[model samples]
Target chain A: MSTILLIEQILNGLQFGVMLFLMAAGLTLIFGVMGLINLAHGSLYMIGAFAAAAVAGWSGNFLLALIASLIAAAIFGVIVEMTVIRRLYKRDHLDQVLATFALILIFSEATRWTFGSFPLFLDIPAVLKGTVILPGGIEYSLYRLTIILIGLAVALGLYLLISKTRVGMRIRAGENDREMIGALGVDISVLYTMVFALGAALAGLSGALVGAIQSVEVGMGEPVLILAFVVIVIGGIGSIRGALAGAILVGLTDTLGRTLLPVLFSSFMDGSAATTVGSALASMLIYILMAGVLIFKPTGLFGSA
Target chain B: MISKNAKRTVKALGAATALALSLGQVAVADGHAGKLKVGMLTTLTGGGAGLGVDIRDGFLLAIEQSGNAGIEVVVEDDQRKPDIAVQVADKMIQSEKVDILTGIVFSNLALAVAPSATAQGKFYISPNAGPAQLAGRGCHENYFNVAWQNDGPHEAAGATANKMGIKKAFIWAPNYPAGQDALTGFKRTFEGEVAQEVFTKLGQTDYAAEIAQMRASDADGIFFFAPGGMGISFLKQYADSGVDLPLVGPAFSFDQTILPAVGAAAEGVLNTAQWAPDLDNDASRAFVESFKEAYGRIPSIYAQQGFDTGLLIASAATKADVKDADAFRAALREADFTSTRGDFKFGNNQHPIQDFWVRKVIQLDDGTFINTAVEVALEDRQDVYATECALDW
Candidate 1:
């Protein structure tokens, strides 16, 4: 309940939010641009973590591992888009969901086939191994702080990419009218492939970064994927700005609720009972936030009506 | 090689990959009138696969090593669901005609299956998941738990906490039934002030907020009991958070199954267990050596539990006729097998009466992680619930 502890919890929430944004941004972009409901986005994230872990183990270089994650995810994303997702775009959301859901099963089993069921080891590089004292006298994980910075940088970079770049313009245009862009001599298929790869790469990078702190294992992506979906829903699906906003909001709400609710309940209730009740409620907090947002805006904070 | 032993398990995983990844490797059917048929219904898919797979591998390995053609095992995956466990238990008893039922890695599933299995007069020798009721007032004479009761590790952890001189402690667990039991069990024996007790969401991977609270609070130690993936996440985060509080926990988190994933973060942490890989005994040493050679990984206590169950069955099968129900039950009750965990006997409730050891997580020179025996925490410990069990012998 101390101010310093509260500050640290807030930072933790921000870090968690940024991680979700990394997943949500790609999901929103894919949905916005192609109208494809990609449930396998989490699979790409899992692939990123596995690739990072494998590379990191082989060369003993975290940087190389990080690079490998992005490359691997992008390559896989492109391959999947060309092979399967390219067809689903013309079909309904149900078909896309069913196909992508199948991809999740394939990816999870294939990853398990490759990595085995035991969790793989991945740690933050030695330089970022421990905590750092923030300006407000709060001791925070250096790795987490790095993740927050990376996430914000990605957000800003994405803003510039979409607004200032030609490719970004094409993507925005494609979102408005896919057939029109194709008729205007832009290879919509190539644009779609590139966009999908970019989205996959973002998800992969998030997975690798988070995998260093958490476990690199099968089904790891799923829980985060649900939260990421919540983020995009709250922020507005297909909107990068919405995804970022929604991710941070969800992250802060979830983390702060988990930390403070028990203390809040302990004020009136006993400790054990308070912890039980608080945590049970805390698990529902994000979904509550999502429901509240959807009730009001329907299209989300940044999503179009 | 980390994957050398994994090759055997990987084959089993490959076997499971085909059937929607729920059922385990079904054995070749060869029913004999005299041989004991054991139904090993356990979780082989979903999140709980690791524990179940380990149990199956260990049980099968022991059966293979004994070269005992007298015992046949039929393995099924309960999918970690209570309904599925019940359904599978019925199948094993009715259709498969397994004379003895075992290999459930969870308590709820055990609670779902054991009462019915024992009521049907099929012997259920548990490899893991000894719920309190099965060891207490609800104890069935036909059910035998080779592993310790549900609160065994926690009760021993409380005792070890006292021995280690921890004065004030922070406790954390997932909000679930077993998690609640863990808290009550720890506090039952602990003679210390509670700095804080926190229950996290089940399946939660991040523990940053809780770590911050631990650092800020006036606690001397931390006690946690998050199993499988959740534990790995917490240990890694706890290490990086720069908190120096000594930790005491049950072996579920620090077992060989996950220590490799947790890495150096878990080094030197103390956990309570009924057996350690480095236990000094003939059966214990032999089991460890062969388990590593057979599986290419260190056997967690889950595997040890399965191995012990196998031995217990083999001993009984050799001593008395399975056709003679009373004789077989008495022979099994004699508990004559040389256990991997030292000085094992069954209390009146048919749960294990054995020593609980304090194991310290240490990285071997070979870079694999294992829990080596540090000290005897509780010698010849018996569960307090045996007196409450009203089953007449």
Candidate 2:
């Protein structure tokens, strides 16, 4: 790969990593503090994309559409947490998984019923539609670059919310000792709801951002949900920092593996064999990375235990 | 005494109703000699539901128009899973005792059910998916594919690329049986140097890595066989990636069902299909009109295939008894129906031998995108695998 191409691929990897982190952050928060596995996080992502598309269609304003996604997903998150998710936190992991998995089906079917079976269009705004040449004559998509900046902004904002703020301090305490935080006169349930909503809004934001480029369809959330799970698991189940690190690692591995492996194999094997072997290996690269991480650090890169 | 009397009356009523039901069944069976029980195992729910819904609606529309009460259709959702498709096929075969099986959307699901369904003397009429194995090595006498072979459109895409004067091409498909068939078919006829041939993971939504590679490859044109949502992602991302190369592919990406979803990104792309809405034929015009009238939307390529499958069954039903396997097979081989695509016939492999037309995607005044026929890609096209098919009549 040329240096310029390599730089672009790295940017691509970073962009992908940040997107995963958006999903992973919320996932780690819920799993870390609430000790609740939220499989429907992906559903929230879908909700955001659909909401953005609906709003964008009506308003013709991209910024308004994005804000609508955040608000819509947050509202849905609050409702879901209050009505269904609250019941599962006290239950076993199996029960939680079953209930959340059911939520996924319900969300998918309901969305399909509402939106119809076809995918909806959500194009990138004109201002961010084309590419811009970076320093040293490297051309990159302006929208994707915006996505990276937005993701990093969210990450930094999340850090501030979790560390500097009182709620963040309470969250840390809850992660350390849930009962102790409750004893400290914190309204633990309300805190849980806030954290869940925050995570959900982040997921929705990422969804609306990526949805501009990808498809806005039912079951679109499921794949990203699976990747978020991988991201959290690799990053350490409840650590935002680990989620970021792990997400970047995964994004880089996947993008670079896909681009480079086939070329590397084509050097030795025939064109067809190289592509087959390389791509097969490339798809498995993330899982292999996960396994390797677990082998080395069973508690993930950031887990305390 | 009153309770006992009521019980006795209820028993008498139940017996009378049971006898009448049995007699009614016998009468209906006697009424139509060429009656067919068709079992439709299709994707009715989940990600691929749009295609399945089209197939089911179009087929039923044809049946409804034919005024054929003799064709009793029983439908079941496969949910787009191969194992579920197999289970449903078994249920339809063993319990429903359907004489014919049809309406599988994906090749993986079709391959799972068609072989076993055909082996058990159930006639399998393929409407959408036409895998290469069933056309060549595993060609069954009872299996009749009313749709084009899996690679038929891709082959036409190759020819279209040639016509477009694209000398070097970057071709890609998801790494699976049909995907492999697509790339292989594209290379079969195109007189071009392959800039790159990439096999992506099935259901992969992101194409930045591949798009980047495409920009770097300096290919004259690009041919991609990403069907359904995958195609939408590729189109949107490619349009945004600043790579302004002309895109060419088969019609799966540019069909009525998804073209609207793809929106302006797909406009003006040349794609190949066996059928187009603007085909100058009575049946084709009628189908396009009635389909829109019935469904409140334009019929997709899959729907056209479904209508033809239904028509094929109806025409064959008039001539031969469905219970008689040899006679029914022979009649199906004749392919006596006015297909929405003009001049449809079956090759030796029992797949469609029809003209492949190139269609340019154009947006309507209402801002919805659809394809119109521009030129013929291949005349009276036969699947390349037909010669290998050893099914002797």
Largest DockQ belongs to which candidate? 1
Tens-place lDDT per residue, model 2, A1-305, is: 78888889999999999999999999889978887777788889999999999999888899999999999999999999999999987775556666777787788778888998888888899899899999989888999999999989989998998899988999999888889889989999999999989989998998999899988987788778778877877887789999999999999999999999999999999999999999999999998999899889876888766
The list of candidate 2 runs beyond 4 A from truth reads: B1-35
- Which number leads on lDDT? 2
- Taking the tens digit of each residue's C-alpha lDDT, what string does model 1 give over B100-218? 99999877789899999999988889998887878889898789999988788998899899988999989988876677778888888889988999999877888888998999999
Most TM-score-accurate candidate: 2
lDDT by residue (tens digit), candidate 2, B273-362 = 989988889999999999999978999998998999999998998889988888888998888888889898888889888999999999
Q: lDDT per model, in order?
A: 0.86, 0.86
Per-residue lDDT for B180 in model 2? Answer: 89
Worst 10 residues of 2 chain A by lDDT: A90-99
- Candidate 2 achieves a global lDDT of 0.86
- Clash pairs, candidate 2, are none
* Candidate 1, position B266, lDDT: 92
